[model samples]
Target: MNWLNLEHLLLDESPDRLLCQDPDLTLGQLRRQALCAAAGLQARGIRHLAIHLEDAGELAIALLAAWRAGVSVLLPADLQAETRERWNPQVDLWLSEQPGDTRLGQLYDAEPLPAARLDLDQCSLSLCTSGSSGEPKRIDKRLRQLDNEVRGLEQLWGAELGNACMIGSVAAQHIYGLLFRVLWPLCAGRQWVRRQLPFPEDLQRASLDYPAFAWVASPALLKRMGDNLDWPALSKVRRVFSSGGALPADAALSLQQRLGQWPCEIFGSSETGGIAWRQGETLWQAFAGVQLTQDAEGALQVCSPYLAPGHAEQTADAARFEADGRFELLGRLDRIVKLEEKRISLPSLEQALVNHAWISEARLGVVRENRAYLGALVVLSESGLHALRNLGRRALTETLRKHLSNHCEALALPRRWRLLRQLPLSDQGKLPQALVETLLAAPRGKAPEVLEHKVQDDGLQIELQVPPDLACFTGHFPRTPVLPGVTQVDWALELGQRLLELPPRFAGMEVLKFQQLVRPGDRLTLTLRFDAARSKLHFAYHNQHQAPCSSGRIVLQDSATETAHA
Candidate 1:
């Protein structure tokens, strides 16, 4: 496919394509700088160069120059010694404008420069996968794939993204960020914000700066924004797109509530780009020209001319088809398990638990001692705790049991329960399976001061300490080792349970708050009190310095009929 030249394609529009943050690079300046860079690289005989850069303007220029020169380019994942070593032997050049340009210059000084020859069908770029499961894999792309992708996005986004200022919180090194924020905007003549990585504050700032800003980010960024209690009331954001990880249904609703009613959530992977998008919780219609095919095993398969030909890629996610060519996201195929001779999806159970008023987050996993039994770790809110304490532990567990009984059988009610103020989520907004196992392995006797027992007429008090020797501190940070919030919340609940022993069970928790970081060597105090007759549990937490940290309420179950009911 012969395409328009990069310089002509971009410069033909107008001299004034206003990027929100960057005042330095105008359309004309960008084109000139890219041509110069391309000429320089070609003169140095750097045909196959790999880039590890963060500057949006610089990357755009470099990529455009490489395309114009018909030289191959690779965008590796954020640099590591190992990645450098792997690409070093294979790459003829390393193109970067960082401080260490001289280092690369010294490596390849002898080779003769090549003439600049632009071609449409040449290998354009390669993007590395996220490497969540293993080593990062490289996916090569022709100019055609990118041309089709940008065209598809331009059409699919319609007016929502049309002429909207693209603001991205994710790094440009990744596929999702590169395609939606950089390449699509470049090819489709859309203006974009220059910031490559944006924090919650930066995102809000970008929205305020560019009244027409549309955020393109991953679910991890979205969850972080929601979990950050101090986030400003966002008003200027036009729309937000989420991918990279599964967008939690609750998270989508929360974003819509926080940022004015904006359509959000685009569902896709790096392999297929954006396959479909969800406005709210309801329906997900496939993007234009994307076709869904069911495999022999009843699993969903995809075939789109946008993807490479002669290959059928299967996905682990299952979907329920609707009459209008839309689909509902069912939990992953691997998440389904047989519990008590009944099929159960752990994700479905986890979602149901979090739906409770008292519970802020929950995780359900099947444990096998002699036979498999449902296990749960729950984090409660302040109001949830009050309701649980008022009704008493017996009544609280009974209510929860009956609530879960609607979807799951009697045997599916979690036999073993550990109360927590928050559940651990990975950097990608996924629950860590390995961390769950570690929490479950804690011995019953030494459940720590956090998880023991406390009873008081006025209220109960508890203390939690992040021991420096804990194994988790190592992985959290090698040098500046600290306690992760995941472990902090776990200790908070263990202490909460010890302080307020109620009927051997509790309704759950409510309004549980995490105000700040609790690192190793920081001692935290948990204080609790309750209306015994009314079964109300009120609690407060303070650090070793007596600095007030967080406080909440718990609903306790009355002992009268707790176990018998369960």
Candidate 2:
């Protein structure tokens, strides 16, 4: 992982090593394509290039090509309009794997240029992350810093990884995935998958092909997995690496029971690099050469080779030291609030609530009515939902109140409560504070509640809880209030566009049928699949007992044409 010798990767690597699973690609072929693209970048006089490709192998090639051309790389986290508008001006060119984008393809067919050995500082990278103000904050990293991180990771886990091919859901734009998925395994001569396995079924499928592969996962993907998956097929997974957020205790334990190993949860940020990690343990042990201490305000202070030389950073995260040199995180300093002259720790409250058998996970935050009061967002276990069904909402609330009352003072008790099947985490597995506040302020009865959402490559599956006072059910009553047929069609289109990237111009509907009436308080699972070639969105709604409620095809006009006469 030496910065001076990076050119060896492009020019001198073994020819037979594989880089992709589906295509069964070779390292040499990828390197040649990158070298040609680098030449094109040089010829075009592009200096700062922004890369937002989806394929992992293409992303790696773009990065190397940029570096080889002496062009700085800007790895955008996403391709949203706001993100593009903010970073677009800072970059000289934008690259993506969209249809009709012939820049890279044209370059790959051009005469190849010799790979250039980048200077330790020439191959720089920039990325934007959200700051406290909710605005994007730009962070630049030197090649030296990234190289040191890969080396440190190798020194620690090389023996265990042991030439295993890397595969899983984590993407390459994030720091953790950049290090573990692309750079570390590649530099260590281990084959890496070009596409992400974003589902448990995909993981098991890859395990059958490459029996010795490591998993690069996130909390969101792991949390969505069920016991129905073929877990035994993944028992040969060499290692499991997770980041972006803390892995739930229950998920870790369940995974261990299913796969016979606990995932290695990493603890760090984009600014500080990887600080420490743990294996289903309450405490985190710092990585090699990463010095840790507590500031006067209890914030964790870090000094490591991953940072700029002779630089130290103090993070807002509060930490408590253990006798064995391991540390326990006590959440952020800003998460503590004073209520009735007594301090309340939000994370501590969540931890205590999750300890109860009925509650699987809990998130506590502050919301204001007249004054600030705690709001509890709890993910119920089977027993908790059973109690809720039998005793009703009021009794369920009182039951949780009595359990939490034993652990915290009266001032710290949540005034507002909401139960959910899962936390609404983003694709990157992050639940920000702003989202927490929004969820707390959101009112019921306006729309159906989303209990669980899992996005796939083609489409997504959503579990919706139909509220008794659903706005669409206001007057759609035939003795009993039922969800309107029109409402079901609308929900499919809305969720399809938001989640599945389906086209927006509604042409018409085809083969629409309502098999059963969807009544109030019914739980429904909606599945949406977008067919790009035919411009159709297929949707199906099923009940809790897997009974079909409705199914249809939503025909959409193409981007350049509209069905004006439809």
Candidate 3:
């Protein structure tokens, strides 16, 4: 099951076949370069070498050369200086295409070196997780496991690849790109275009060179292609594959409409490798060797002998089975929300918001304690914003609030709404949760001033004042008498601090659920306790009932006062 053995078999048939983007290194020339690199490594007494390369044809050649030299290969995540410095291996020397330099890149022809035999069962390549949340960790795949992948892929698509050249956007250093662009092509006896397809320009260049090609790329790349480029119908392209992230339904349909064929969407992670592929609206058909089942929680569980043992990895993804024997992936099961004793799906909320005429994209997230507050960040289309500008900001917010209020209760309406210039799009158009938090951290415009009250030094006394004419009550529940929670809190806090110079800043309380709704006639008393050392203030609200209705702790700050004094 040695992958090299399969590669050798393929190479034997086309020693002169092209494997790189470079027109100079024809198939025969690349093989000769690999031999030379092998000899170079042997002469230097090197048994192990790590390759820091972009996804390209030279990288494949260098990898094959390392195998031919009987040297272990390490592929780092990126070529940061620190990454290069951390290349600790069993061997002391390194093999690179950068001749005078030590960096590993696509190879050029060199004199042939002695051939070193490889152990098919041994480790062949090392990959690292993306580590978006933590440090990247390395995972080693055996030559045999990789061989199984190439064999599986060849059996499924080898005939199509026979005449098509490999072309992909993802870097070969990652698992998806490596297997699709290198191993599969070599195993299938297919020629590969040698270069990482980076920009639209690069893809255009490749189209000029290789009329017939197979593109392997991520959903991010495809989404961007839809947004920015008007791609020609890929008449010469045999197939294209997409992976790395969820393929948006709209993006998939639009891409097919433009390209004349839909790219295959792959569902799997690095831990499990390729699992299944979905095209158009079809349910995902499992790859040839992969088996799928469900756990007790109804999550998709994959059992692959080729995967690392000790556990049958069950994914958080929800799925459904079709009578046709295919499986369809639903969204993640972890995205459920419970509010006001009613369970809600954020995705459903987002769908509802985006259904509005003005909104282009939307996401809803719960932020307050006990998930009491739900906030929305919306990206408005140009026409949407223009329409809103005519109504003014306050009118826009009020309009949206009233719109939601009509269908949902006051609590269900987003506590705060902002018109964002753009959606927090990832390299792909998908909104990441982390970026949502960043948007929420920005300062909201301002809370409108309601009423002011003054209290004495003891913090035990209070003064109550009402606005001569209430502006908030103008339309708020016109038929019913009600006070806005925001205005109510502002009035209560202003009056409680009059005499008690207990720090210019005070706390606000929202913990008490309003069991009985407060109306315009309700007289409310609010009290506070300030602890100097802790720089903390606690507030308690009292109305008709003796026991306080709500209490909360707030951290008080005087940075503005100190700055003024300075």
Candidate 4:
């Protein structure tokens, strides 16, 4: 098989063919801009550069320019201040599109330069991976490896998707987004969107303009799409690809029902390029020229042209090969933990919880409390929320425990629980284990003081004294600290459920207004009224002088169906 240098491959394409949307630039224009940028970078004597631009179009141009300048490219996972700080000492220059930063747009006036002849072994690209423990792991790849994968992608899907423009909901920084949204399209001569389609509404609107387009997205964005979308407009979508995490079967089925096609799910990591893909319920099929085998520990091992030549990469995932040469993935071997001398699979437990009718998503982790205990963070389904509202936290927790008791061992059940509106995902669309542990950490300072309590027919009334060392007040504001609005609302509902008869699940809120700010050492009165007939909870916070601090009416639903209807 013949391989082409990155610059040559990009410049060899048709000059007048469209390569990007949003501003709509042709291949010839992109080549000229990249060549000019290459001249600018070469003039600066920058041999190593970090590329963290947000625009896909700018990123492609910058990448080609850096390659032409013989500058090694380091792709940081994010442009956050801390991430940049960590990578600053290693790179010679920082390139970004953010305001006030060093931008490629400045190089537009420079003279176009010749493309560099980069050796396959000499050209290096650095990619970052968030490892199992949430630490960043840097992986270096040769240009040849990327060339092999892009060629494989074109060979597999090029004919079916002939000339389809690429649109993505994922960022171009990560490996998946980098390949599907940027590299594959660049090599295949297909136009791609410059900006990421962050919302379902954006996808619907873009579908109208580009009738033949392929969407590269993640499971997180696809699963949360509400029913209020314009399904008819989405019918124009030719293909959809999902990666970054497991796509729930129900979510895939729902997308197929609305969009007339199932999303093809790709499974791989930063260290290993594209490994396998599957359309719907079928077993994962390895990509062309990719070979899969089991290691001594039964973990999946991949040997492919896409990887470093003559070496195999071991994956954390456990899998079993089917008779038909496909593979079925078991949970990650590293995610299994021991609890009270019993080995428990965290993924299995989470899958069981998600199987419950009331649970939409679940994440399980082991937290330290004298000894290690299981903790769960869950997003409730409509029915689950209804159960929470009517039964309270204790009842809802117990109900879930009871449901798990039928299938899971006693020690495997989660000891603590937190109900959230949605799972906290990092910018890369991954759940950071450290963030989950922080949610279960015990408060450091003294709890708030409850001065007075009274029971009413509709609700309850209480007086609370804000402690100077309240945990929520810490790091909330540096100079003039005031109680956060979210904290106030959370306290009202938590205290109401504990002291009075308030619902457990959060449904909806209306007329929420914050008039005055509460500070440390302030005495505030809280009033909560439950309207069972209307399924609404009215709450208000007032200062010692009876001036309103905040007020809201929260609506409760009996089932997810009811929530959807309302």
**Best model per TM-score:** 2
lDDT of 4 by residue, 1-566 (tens): 12233547545556776788768887788788888998888888888899988889889889888887788999998788888888888898888877766888876666878745556677789998865455787889988888888888878887877777898899888889999988888877788888888777787677667758888988888887778787877777778989888887778999999988899999998889999999977589999888899888789998989788898999878898989889888778788888878888887788789989888888888888888888898877768766654455566778899989987898888888877656766535678776777776645343457867898776788988775435565556534456888888788777867876655677888899999988755779999988877778789999989999999987765556466787
Full candidate order by TM-score, most accurate first: 2, 4, 1, 3
User: Global CA lDDT of candidate 3, please?
Assistant: 0.62
**Candidate 1 accuracy as lDDT:** 0.64
Per-model TM values vs. the true structure: 0.66, 0.79, 0.63, 0.77
Off by over 4 Å in 3: 1-13, 39-48, 69-71, 80-101, 105-113, 116-118, 133-135, 226-233, 309-311, 333-436, 439-566
Candidate 1 residue-wise lDDT at 476: 58
Model 3 C-alpha lDDT per residue in residues 483-511, reported as the tens digit of each score: 56666555545543543455665433435
Clashes of 3: 14
**Which portions of model 1 show Cα errors greater than 4 Å?**
1-16, 82-120, 133-135, 224-234, 335-345, 360-566
Backbone clash tally (model 2) = 0
| Candidate 3, poorest ten consecutive residues by summed lDDT | 461-470
Off by over 4 Å in 4: 1-7, 10-13, 108-110, 116-118, 442-566
Clashes of each: 44, 0, 14, 4
Cα lDDT listed for each candidate: 0.64, 0.80, 0.62, 0.80
Model 1 residue 106 distance off true place after TM-score fit, in angstroms: 11
Report the Cα RMSD per candidate.
13.4, 7.3, 16.6, 12.7
Of 2 and 3, the candidate ranking higher by TM-score: 2
